[model samples]
Target: MMNGWIISAAAEIFWREENKMAEARSLEEIKLDYAWKFGCGRYIQQREALETLPEEIKRLGDKPLIIAGPRAWEATEGRIEKALREAGIEYVLSVYPDQNTYEKAREHASQAVSSGCDVIVGVGGGRIMDQAKASAYFAGEMTKARSGHFPVVQVPTSIATCAAFAPLSVMYTQEGASLGSLRHNFEVNAIVVDLDVIVKEPARYVASGILDGMAKMVEMQNGHDNITIEEFDVGLVTAFTLAKYTMETYRKRGVQAVEDVRAGKLTKEVEDITYLNIAVAGVISGCSKGFGQTALGHECYELIRTHFTQEAKDFIHGEIVAVGQSMQLSFNGQEDQIPALREMMNSFDMPLTLKDIGIEPTEENVETLYQDLYHSPFVKDCPEEAEKLRKAMKWLCE
Candidate 1:
C-alpha cells in the first residue's frame, strides 16, 4: 500500500512539473514588435577612432547638439567640439548640473531646444544619457509623429546601468528618492564607450552596478504572471546567463576590479563588466520586454510616497536598489544569503541597509510601503507574489 501511494504521489509531482513547464513555454512565445535595437557595438574603441567621426556624425545628422553632465563639461565639450569641428558637423553643448534628476534633464532639454539642436550627443554617466534621451523626446513632442527625431549617441562614463543604451530612461525628481518613473523617451542611435572614461568612474558605482545586474537574474527565476515578453524563454535565459557571469566576475574580483578601473587597468575581465553594465543589460531591457515579469523584491515605489527624504534621494541610485535588494532577500526567507551579499558589498563599501544609506525604517515608512506594495505594477501582475512580498516586507520591518 505504501509503495502504491508513493508511486501515485511521484506521478502527480511529475504531472505538475509538466503543467508548469507548459505554462512557462506558452508565456515564452509572446513577443513584442517594436522600434528598438540593442547590442554591444565598437564601445572599447570610440575615443581612439575619433578620426572616423566625420562619417559617423554625418550618419546621425548634419547638426548635433551635445548634452553632458556638469562633470563632463570640460572633458566632453572640448573634445566633442574638436571632433565635430573636424567632421564639419555643426554642434552646441548643454551641460546639466546634476545627473539623476528629471528636472535637470528637463532643464537641459529646454536649453537644448532653445538652441535649435536637431541631434543629441549624450556624454557622461547613465543619468546624463537618460537626460539626453528625455530632452530629445520632450523637445520634439509636437513633431515626433511616427519616427522620432533627434538621433542620440549615448556615451557612458561608467558602465553602471544600461539606461543610456535603452529606449527607456529612468527619471528621478531628486536624489535618494524613489525611481521617479521609467519613461519610453528616446532610443539610442549609437553608443560611444571610451573604456578609459569608464575606468575613471568611482568603485562604489561599479559595485552597486553589480547588485543591479544580479537583480535581473534573481528576479527572472521567479517569473511574473503578467507583462509577458515575447520569446521570453530565450531572453530570460540569456539575461540570466549574462547577469550570472557579471556577478561571478565581481565576486571573484572584488575591489581589485574597482581599483584596476580607477588605475586605468582595463583588462578582459573588467571589459566584460563594462559589457554587462552597458551592453548586455541594455539589450535585455530593450528586446526582452520582460518589464513586469520579474518581481521587485523591494516593495516597488513604496518608498517614494513617504520615505525618501530630500537628502536621501540625493544619494546614488544603485545604492538605494542595493539596500532594497537586501530587504527583499530577507523577505524571501533568504536571510542566510545576506552575509555573503554584505561581504561582497563591503568589498566596495557598498551600502547594504537602509541605515547605511542614511535612512531609517520608521513606522511611517513601513506603513506607506506596506500599503503601496499591494498596488505596485509588478505586484498586480502576480498577486500571490505580492502577498509574499507583503509578508517579506512586514517581517523585515519587524
Candidate 2:
C-alpha cells in the first residue's frame, strides 16, 4: 500500500522520505486504520517458556534470526538453542553492537536478507527488541515483501520497557534525541516471557520497567485524563483504561514485585508487574497515534537526554523518563500525586532529582533544559508553558 508504488532501492528511498515527512506532520494529520499486531504477547510464563519458541517460529518462518546483545544471548542461548534443535529448526544468531543505532539496524536488515532468514527473534531488553523490529521493517523495503516486515518474535529477557510488545520501535538519534517512532501496521508474530529468566536480573530492571509502564498513564492522560469515557477512539479509550488499571495495580503490588525480583524469586506480583511493563504498556503505545501519547514528561526526556550522557551512561530509558515524570506532574498541575510517587521512587532507589542521577542543576544546564522545552516545536510556544516546565524541572533538580 505504498502511495508512490515503488520497490527495492526506490522503495528504500521512499521509506526514508516518508519518515521525514511523518516527522514534519502534526499528530492530527496522521491516521491509523485498525492496526493491532496481537492483543499482547502470548502468555506462557512457566520455566519452560522457551519450549514454545519452536512452535511459534514454525508458525511464522522456517529459518529464524535471533538478535541479542552478548549478555542476553549468553543468558538464554542454552535454553533457546535446545528448544530449536530438538524441533529441527535451523536458526541464525546475530549480535547487535552495544550502541543502539539506525546504522546497526540497517546492518542487521541486510543480514536478514542475505542470510535468507524468514523471521526475527528479539531476545533481550528494549534495545535489542527495537533493533530487531526496525531491521525487519527495513528488510521489507529491501525486498519486495507484501507486508513490509518479516514476522518478529519477541522474547523479553528483562522488563525495562515494552518494546517487546509495542507495535513500533522507539527511535533515537545516535546522540540520543528522539526521532519519534517507527510504527508498524503489523504486530510481532509472537511474544514469550520466561519468569525464571527475568527474575534473575537486577531488581532495578523491574523497578525501571514499572516506571516506564507508569509513563503511559501519566503522559497519555495529561490531555484526556477523564475516567468516564464518553466519545473517542475505542483503542485510545481501551489503552487509557488499561493504563489506569496498571497504575492502580502498581500502587498496590509494585513494591512487592520489585522486592521479589531483587530476591530472585518469582511471585504473582512479579509476574503481573512484568506483564504490565511489556504487554500493557505496549498496548498503550501501539494504540497511541502520533503525539497523542506524548506530553511534557516524555517530551522532557527527549529534549534533555543528550545533555548528560556521561551521567546517564548506566541509565536506562525508563529511569530518565522518571525524571521527566516529575516535570510532567508539576507542569500539568498534578501536584497532589507527587508526594506518593516521590516516596516510592526514593524507596526503590530510583532517581527523584537531577542530582540523584548525577546531573547538576547548574545555571547553564538548567537554562538549556528550559530553553529546549520553551522552543520545542511539539508544544505551543507560550510563556506560561515555559514557566511550568521550568518550575517542574527546577523542583525535580532541587
TM-scores of the candidates are: 0.77, 0.89
Model 1, 318-344: lDDT tens digits are 666666665556545566766787677
Cα lDDT tens digits, model 2, 1-398, are 12111124643454566464343333454555454544343645567798888998898889988998788877785999899999999888987656555677788888888998988889988888988888888878788699888888888899988888777776655655445566766677788988778989889989998887787777775533363456666666777788889999998999999999888889988888987888778767766642445665666665555556566667777787888787777666787888888888887899877777777778887776667665554345566666666677766675
What pairs collide in candidate 1? 30-230, 31-230, 175-313, 175-314, 176-312, 176-313, 176-314, 177-313
In model 2, the runs with Cα more than 4 Å from the true position are: 1-21, 24-43, 173-178, 223-233
How close to the true structure is residue 159 of candidate 1, measured as C-alpha lDDT? Answer: 65
- Top candidate (TM-score): 2
